[model samples]
Target: MSSRSLPTRQLATVLFTDVVDSTRQLAQSGDQVWARLLDALDAVSRSEVRRRGGELVKSTGDGALMLLPSPTAAIECATALHAAAGQLGVTLRIGAHTGEVERRGLDVAGMAVHVAARLMGSAGSGETVVSATVQALASPAAETYDDRGELSLKGVPVPVHAFAIRQASPPPVASAPLPVGDDRDAVTRLLRERRYEEAAEIAPEVDAATLAEALLAAGGRVEFLDVDITLVRMLQDVLDRLPADDAVTRSRTAAKLAFELRGDPSTAQDRRDLLDLATQLAESAGDAQAASEALLATVNSLWEPTGALDRLSAAERVITLTRRTNDVDHELEARLARLHALVEVWRIHDAGLELATYARLAARLDRPELNVFVASRRGMLAQISGRYDEQARQGEIAYTNAVAAGMPDAERLRMSHLFPIERDCGTGPDLFEAGLEMLRELTGIMPGNFYEADVAWVLLTLGRRDEARTELARALPPLLTSSGYRWLFSAVLAAETTAEVGSAEACQRLYDALLPHQDLLACVGPTFGGGVGERLGLLALRLGRTDEALERLARAVGDFDEIAALPWATRARVHLASALRSAGDIEGADSRLAEAKDTARALGMARMLAQIEAEDGGR
Candidate 1:
């Protein structure tokens, strides 16, 4: 064809597929067998592409690239190819993207093709991944897309949003009749009865408005009352089935779902994204209450210091919007969110003021749950600020209120919160043992990386280095599966534990994984502790990088003190002092050690005080 007559660019869906572990298959099975298998795979892939109106552009030995008219066609073709390859005892990793592509004779070249190839490389064996553009164009089929979030594709200039397409299930048949009584009441009864599957099945039979109301009501009823993962999943499915055009319904449901997923280590990333999406939707819908709630949820999810500025910004917006709308509940929530973010960012004075305002609002509102939440925040603040006795006192009140108010997860939260306080106070080995036991039990009830890492931290503190290492190993798998403040905290704890018991090489691996996020700050326990930089300093010390350790620890100490985290500041000082002493800087070491000792004594930290005294005695 003449260049003038040829099509330079056209919108198309590009699909890339490759055999999983082709090298292994070739090495295990000789060239003869491999060639046969490759032939069979190529035949099946081409057949699927042809059936879906996709043109095979070229083959790359173990796989082929194809072009389809639409994203739906491309996705269907990829899914079919996956199933066909599975039947052939082969696994294929596939990726698809919808964008403008340059048609060069029989072959195609463009950003879309490169993106698809990178996405294919990202997919696991037998998995199909697609770019957000493809997902948006796939229409009803897009509902099957499970968001994998943004991924840094190799060779791509920017991060690409990707989704994994799950195998489609048959549409639910409304064969079952709706339960009797009020629609909301029926759904609530089913949820309370734990008939989640049945509730989900019947939810779509109700009108869209009624289903939205029932789902929101059911969500509120079970939110703090139980750990019902199945119920939450069912509710999400029901909400997904509701009319998408109703932004209010979508925003409310998303906010409610985000709340349900918050603090759940397995769903931390999801919670963050869902809250963000909810905020956007609510704002677009002009629903101030929903937007404020979503903003609060967003603030709760952002545990990293890097996120502190964004968290504060969102909180301030929430306050402004709620005040204008006269939403007292949301206004109080905004104040609490602002207080939390302020603390994370080391703006203690601002946090203290916000905390006082929050306390007054909670009192005036006379909400028991709100009172418990405020008390918990106060206890956390006091612990960080070197007020150990006040922390203990506030903690007791918070736990009491939590129990009295019937918060189902209250005991687990309380135990986790108090363990570090006890450790700092040298309250006894018994508290650590008790904390470990509680964590073990809680893990059985709801397994998570956070609980496992907490267990590892306690074990490390108790000097059971080997046991802590094992617990850290157990925690690593889940931490690798997600990204969020909780995951970062867990990963850091695991790294610290590993450094205590594992080889320098193993410690190096963990440290490298954390390097990218070193600037992120988060609460380690009841205090604003565990900045990425602080943990890096500890890792550096373990790796025998004394000068680097001293520098990083000094920075960490300054950061902690600025945030009014006296306990953490003392800990950082102690680390710095130890590094300084090792480097023969006697005067510098003495100054840091004296500062640490004084702070520890003020905080009533017996264990740290004893350690400092022993070091001084040795000198």
Candidate 2:
């Protein structure tokens, strides 16, 4: 009944070789000349294959695929082919990989063949790219290699570590004195002690490769120590002197420097530029893992809602490419980047699917860092879905894991999510206050204003309007041009707090700034909460725009009710009641207030219930 044929499998080393910029060459040379040149190139390729004991599968116009007995033979043949092609005035880009392939008569098929083709595409003219398997099988003396790092080949489900086969090995360097073998630890300790000039001077005494590694490690440690600008500059100077072809070192250094710059709001544009540059370098070197990392950095820096879809698309590409390479850590990170973009665009279902994949990968990889990150994301998702109990449980797990891993920053981030969950779950303000203290400690240690917006929200809710206003001032400047979860949350908090404590002119300015983004929803958990519209309504009411206030608050109540966010819906109803009273609908106001009170009582939202009672008493 089945018309499909099963593929016959065989282990072989697949090699793909192609002419670089063939189209451009074709355009420059007429059809006849190009045809003759390709013919000559094919003749040389066939001769090399026969001489090196390989079976030529087929010619793909300007490229050819060959099957060799072993990876060693494949590299040998490729090297000879490179030399022969050069002699014929044809520059060739070659790629080789050893894996199980499907032998279908004269042609071979399978991921191994495809991966080789992709690697060839990634190679430059006169260069040969090979997978880790090829590198492992080949005799080291026969071919020197430059480790290319991990690459996500097209149609591959995982990342592959590749190496560029050098034509010859370099001459050995004269042995150095000054304990070069033990310099890595010394450099690390000096960097840790903040002795930047001393570390910089000592780093160069070791070999270039070893020094690059030391700089990358030292740079990461310095980032945790409050982002020393002077030290970053020193590291950059060292990296700049290294070989341009050293992509792995360059990509890692660029990514680390970008992260350090991101901590300072003043360097936002620099951070963006550096990340984009890093992406280009990674792509040029065919380092998909590094490319994905750069893209994730770009996603983190993107604050505009208009760019969300573009960033999401880039993240998806990285995810697909990372998955093809079978790199668990990078794949999980790419998935998380995609998930963040999904959540920003209010695509909850897609985000959930990504989370599921992330969880599976984290478990399979047995990476504690991944587990802690997954737990943090799961806790955030649970909070959005109104599963406060699950949120609290996951939050605790994330916190414990973070602490055990010595990731203080991750612990602080989880605390940020936990504070809101505690409030919504009807946990007392004492715990919320404790969470704030932890956040304050983190801010003191890190010296960043990211926590100020969260601090403002808690202060406003506790009725410390003056303190909330101060915190809002500190949080608002950098967030003015930004959009997304944190930016939206900050805007909502500023709008509500300003309406209560700031001057009418200041409140109106905040209102005007927020009006354009009124349609953007605040992501609380699994659902879009009423925070944005409700705060907008309250600000409008304060500005004597009763009609606008009622309109916005009504929409807010509907959205909250649709998601079954009882506490949020209750808060929206209370605001709607006040807006109604301002519009001279006393009876409607009474009805809305009564409904809000009942919902608050049913949900055991003590803070919300108290607010409703206070509003009623004021009326």
Please provide TM-scores, in order, for all candidate models, with all chains considered together.
Answer: 0.57, 0.55
lDDT of 2 by residue, 39-158 (tens): 556556656666655677666657778888666778777877776666656799999887645432223565677778888888887888988777876666345678999897655645
Candidate 1 overall Cα lDDT vs. reference?
Answer: 0.67
TM-score of 1: 0.57
Rate residue 437 of model 2 by lDDT: 72
Question: What's the CA RMSD for each of the models?
Answer: 21.1, 19.4
Q: Looking at model 2, report the run of 10 residues with the lowest lDDT sum.
A: 1-10
Could you give candidate 1's per-residue lDDT for residues 1-619 as a string of tens digits? 0010011233468899998988888899975566556655655665667766667765566787888867778877776777667766778999888654544322456556778888899998878899876786674553566799989876454577889887743222211221224333445435433466777776666676765654554422211222356657755775677676788778767766765554344555676677777888888888886777667666654543345676688779988998898777557756765775665556778878898887886678634455566677788778777787788787888778655543333465476557667767874798788777877765554333256876788799888988988887777655544444345666767766766776687667777767866766655323444577878888888899988988889999998887777888888888788888888999998999999998888878998898788889877
lDDT of each structure? Answer: 0.67, 0.64
Return the top candidate by TM-score: 1
- Residue 602, candidate 2: how far off, in angstroms? 4.3
